[model samples]
Target: MSNIIQRIEAFSQLGQFLSQFTTERISKKEQVLHNDLFFDAFKMQVERAQEFNGWFTLDNVLFSCEGWSKSLTNENLNKFIDSINIKKNTPKTIAIIMAGNIPLVGFHDFLSVLLMGNSVVVKQSSNDKHLLPILAKYLEYIEPSLKGQITFTEEKLENFDAVIATGSNNTARYFDYYFGKYPSIIRKNRNSIAILTGNETDDELNGLADDIFRYFGLGCRSVSKLFIPKGYNFDKLFNAVFKYKDIINNAKYANNYDYNKAVYLMSLFDLLENGFLMLKEDTSYASPIASLFYEYYDDSNSLKEKINSDKEKIQCVVGNGFIDNEIAFGQTQLPTLLDFADGVNTLEFLNNL
Candidate 1:
């Protein structure tokens, strides 16, 4: 096999490593799987990654695809790949300061750096301290030699050829000031948004539920804001999300819902004509419940312009006939090995650099 193909194969095996501790059959460390909040993170990815060989295969296949390996639209890939192909001897180390908003958000950068033949030094998030090591450990079990290349550290960020960091808007400024001197892809505060027309059906809305509720709506990829058409009825939207009412059952989430609800009611009793916890209303991308997010819009074009003006603050757009429950956002635990951060084409960036 070609050397490039061989490298892809080696890295793709990480899926197997991560899948070993199936998200379903939680390792002994997990005291609870499903609870008052929702299915625990990695609750879905591990089972699906392990059982669905088709998806696992697709994950690996897509990793090797030009769209991923080249990390650019087809037009951009050709130019980038040609340049990289000519610079085989250039050595690089990519220091990734990963976000822990959703589980395994860091993995995407990890895979990209590895596939491109750049060594990685990762500084993990404090909140989400699990999974990466489990993945790294399993990968090493299968291929002992790779143990050296993948590592998790609390190390200070110094002496790296390049850097990629994902964090809050406040932190981004700091990251920029500290790390901007070098080649970097430092991301700031950004949230995904959904645009809605009144015509959406039950299935479409449920799909949107995953986008907003997954990772308890904490990640940048989560729907921090939403855009809906004028006079959109909450009845229809709530009806769509009702299946996930169980999200309230999770203890942490339930606490958030209750706490926020009480605060809203006490602060503005008359303004809150709607009930406790989540009220039906027009508002913004931030949600009312502990594990929810929302935003409402009256004019689609106006909101589009608003979003366009602030594109850096927004991530993916979800809505209307396009939403599908099958397509998860921030597939927290088992991120597609190829998904790049900040929608920036890392390989293309490297090639151009």
Candidate 2:
């Protein structure tokens, strides 16, 4: 088999192994590669992931795993990398500094670097330290040639040809100062928003709920704010998303809800609530946990222009025909391989390097 084909097959096998752990729970499937060797161990890793990071609930962890399983199919893999040439040469080392906001949050960058025929040195966030390493081990065992291409470090990174770092606005400056000389992709805080036209169906609004509450609104693609027509009532939205009211049962989410609600009440900020989510009027793109910010739009055209002008602060805009290349409502988290983060093509960047 060719080098790239072997690598791709390794990833595909990893995806099939991960598909067993879905939103339901982790289960062992017969005939999977390495199932006899690693199945029990990986299940333990899933539990360990949540124990290390309270935000990495089993459901969310499995959700992330399922998404990758679907994306790593042969067809999707071919489509994502076919346009970008990767030669079998001495590959450069790409150091990646990953965020821990959600489960397997940095896998795409890791996958990108590997698919570009480069070695990766990863520094993972302490909050998300367990799962990816186990998956990497599975990959190495599947394709022995990949044995030395992946490395994980807890110490400071060194001796890398390029870098890709994801962090908050504050950490981004630090990365820029440190990695400015290297060919790098340093991502800062970016939040998604939903544009409501007062004509959305109940199902669409429910889908929007998935976008908002999937990762407890921690992902860059999570909708933190909303743009609604002037004088539009939020009753329908609240009703549509009410089915997700069980989210309040989670202690962390409940604490955030109670705390933010108390703060809003103490400060006399006028807001809307539905026993779980709080909607406050604000202009910010990034909202706090358990709270969503909203703004009034007088004209759709003007709103489109505003969103266009502030594209850097935005990630995915969820709406129907609201703007060019807008993400459909509720599909923000279901990003395809071609849906590169920050609209920057990672393969192209690695090829150039």
Candidate 3:
């Protein structure tokens, strides 16, 4: 098997390959490796993803690709790898059960297991099954030694040393029961929130809109709720996010908006809405599609205590300076490789295993 350096180069090459598919356009770049063998096939897979899953629109899939392209650079990969201590040991096959809520959501775990010189048997979410296998083929073509190291499966997983599973709260219970004997990391439902001080500039507010609306708020990093100061003007936020009004044109998103809106109206819930988005005052972190739940905070200290108490339910906190490790306005989705999900260090977990 190739050493860690070679593995890094393979992923960096994969990043270059992904650069061709972005939100702006999908044009082939000649400099990327194995383009003749993989480019068009990968493009077709992107379209197939959109056709198979209503949430996986072309723009959203491309955005995911674009994010990976940026993250897989040589500098970023090296930095991420250098942060961890890699022990030369016999390889273990790690079982991964992935969620399909957003495009390539499980790719991070897939990459992490491989980078640690471990084999992976992936059970992908049917909602997001198309893109990763083709990309895995690209990896094999770039580094033939990796061919047998990666495996995708629909059958029951076996012959693995450890497990990592992501799902909703209900499925998490099952994962805990079934994988209890192994060294495992089980992730359940969690949502992101933003803290607003009413002093944000228009650009900052626009960035916040990206944090909220990107991926149709399906990813765990997506901001689904807000904590704003008392008497904060809603008009400022509504005006800033108006540029994303075109999101309503997507049939699936529009359907969700209409349905959620009807339910809210029928329940006599007070809501503040623009044509595309609706905001309701609530305490929950996971808001339904097309609606953002917000809470009024009288003071920052109390809000901080509240968030700290519910840390397990929160993913990324979007704020300027409200708390330690707060993600700046719209940057939640652009997490670096070191930003482990659920605050569990995946690389460290794999290393310890």
Q: Which runs of model 1 end up more than 4 angstroms from their true locations?
A: 1-3, 17-89, 141-147, 269-284, 288-298, 321-339
| Best prediction by lDDT | 3
lDDT (tens digit, per residue) of candidate 3 on 1-353: 77899999999999999999988999999899999999999999898787899999888899999999999999999999888888777889999999999999999999999988999999999999999999999999999999899999999999999999999999999999999999999999999999999999998999999999999999999999999998899999999899899999989999999999999999999999998899999989999999999999998888999999999999999988779999988798899999999999999899887
| Model 3, global lDDT | 0.94
Model 1 residue 156 CA deviation in Å: 1.3
Candidate 3, position 329, lDDT: 84
> On residues 85-174, what C-alpha lDDT tens digit does candidate 2 reach at each position?
765556899999999999999999999888777899999999998899999999988988888889999998999999999999999999
lDDT of 2: 0.90
Clashes of each: 11, 0, 0
Q: Total clashes, candidate 1?
A: 11
- Candidate 2, poorest ten consecutive residues by summed lDDT: 1-10
Provide the TM-score for each candidate, comma-separated: 0.72, 0.97, 0.98
Better of 1 and 2 by lDDT: 2
List the RMSD of every prediction in angstroms.
9.1, 1.3, 0.9
Question: What lDDT does each candidate get?
Answer: 0.55, 0.90, 0.94
TM-score of 2: 0.97
